[model samples]
Target: MALKQIWEETNMKIIVKDLSPVLLQTKNVFEVADQKLFRYGHLVLPCLSQNYGPTYFCKLEKIN
Candidate 1:
């Protein structure tokens, strides 16, 4: 959740998959955790998370 907090500090909306199963199951929306990220994108962070493992960041609509 620390990474998510950092993103929020910078005004970015990130979906840290696994944390939300319903969101992951959503069709044609976005692919998160376990699945390989971006066929056209690159790794953003090479660090570890305290709550989530080997963190995978997903961009999603912001929630207010």
Candidate 2:
């Protein structure tokens, strides 16, 4: 999580997998956390730049 924040701060692109299930299963948690952290504060809005890479793969063999 700290690495992710650093990357975001440096304006690097992030590739997160599908989170539909996570969101569906943690709606209450999301709401509570969001309310606590983002209540009247600054936020870093993402930009739609054309330089993002593919989504992160959990298990994929890399060829030498």
Best by TM-score: 2
The residue-level lDDT of candidate 1 at 18 comes to 38
Q: What's the distance in Å from true for residue 41, model 1?
A: 20
Per-model TM-score versus the true fold: 0.21, 0.22
Task: For candidate 2, give the lDDT of residue 9.
Answer: 75
Model 2, global lDDT:
0.37
lDDT of 1: 0.44
Among residues 3 or more apart in sequence or in different chains, the pairs in candidate 2 whose N, CA or C atoms overlap within 3 Å are none
Which residue ranges in model 2 land beyond 4 Å of their true spot? Answer: 1-15, 32-64
lDDT (tens digit, per residue) of candidate 2 on 9-51 = 7665544343344545745433222323432322222334633
lDDT of 1 at 13: 61
Per model, state how many residue pairs clash.
0, 0
Q: Worst ten-residue run, lDDT, model 2?
A: 54-63
